[model samples]
Target: METRIFFNPGDSIANIHDYNEAVRQGQIFKRERHSDDLVIAKGPGDEEYAIFYAKDAVKNPGKGQKPYDVKNTL
Candidate 1:
């Protein structure tokens, strides 16, 4: 059997085109956790969400783009 984790989504930001817009518009594309390495995925309409991997998933860095530490609270 496979295990899964659910991450909640944030409020919508209407009409974003691609990665750069995601950055310019103050979206989070990077995160640091003790275990899982996180990823940012775009939906069919270019809305972004989080996909947490049990193993490392540090794949795309948005073409030499810098990382953003999106603020969060428990």
Candidate 2:
């Protein structure tokens, strides 16, 4: 079986367990913009939802690109 996870643009980001499960299943992960006008995704990786950015996703909306804490939380 395959499962996918979705998150709204500008929402608090968290690692998806599906990513690890996909790896275990030998399935390819994917990430893309649902709508270009809504948000723009960045990064050059093979993982979907690897990194996403939105204009109003931050407090200082125009402070360049915001950084995601991609590192392990624990």
Best by TM-score: 1
For residue 66, give model 1's deviation from the true position in Å: 27
Tens digits of lDDT, candidate 2, 1-74: 22222334335332343444323222221223232222222222434433232333443324344433232111
lDDT of 1 at 11: 22
Candidate 1, position 41, lDDT: 39
**What TM value does model 1 have?**
0.25
Model 2 residue 45 CA deviation in Å: 6.8
User: Over the stretch 1-74, how does candidate 1's per-residue lDDT look in tens digits?
Assistant: 22222222332232244555544333243332332333333433334433333132223444333232222211
Return the clash pairs for model 1, or none: none
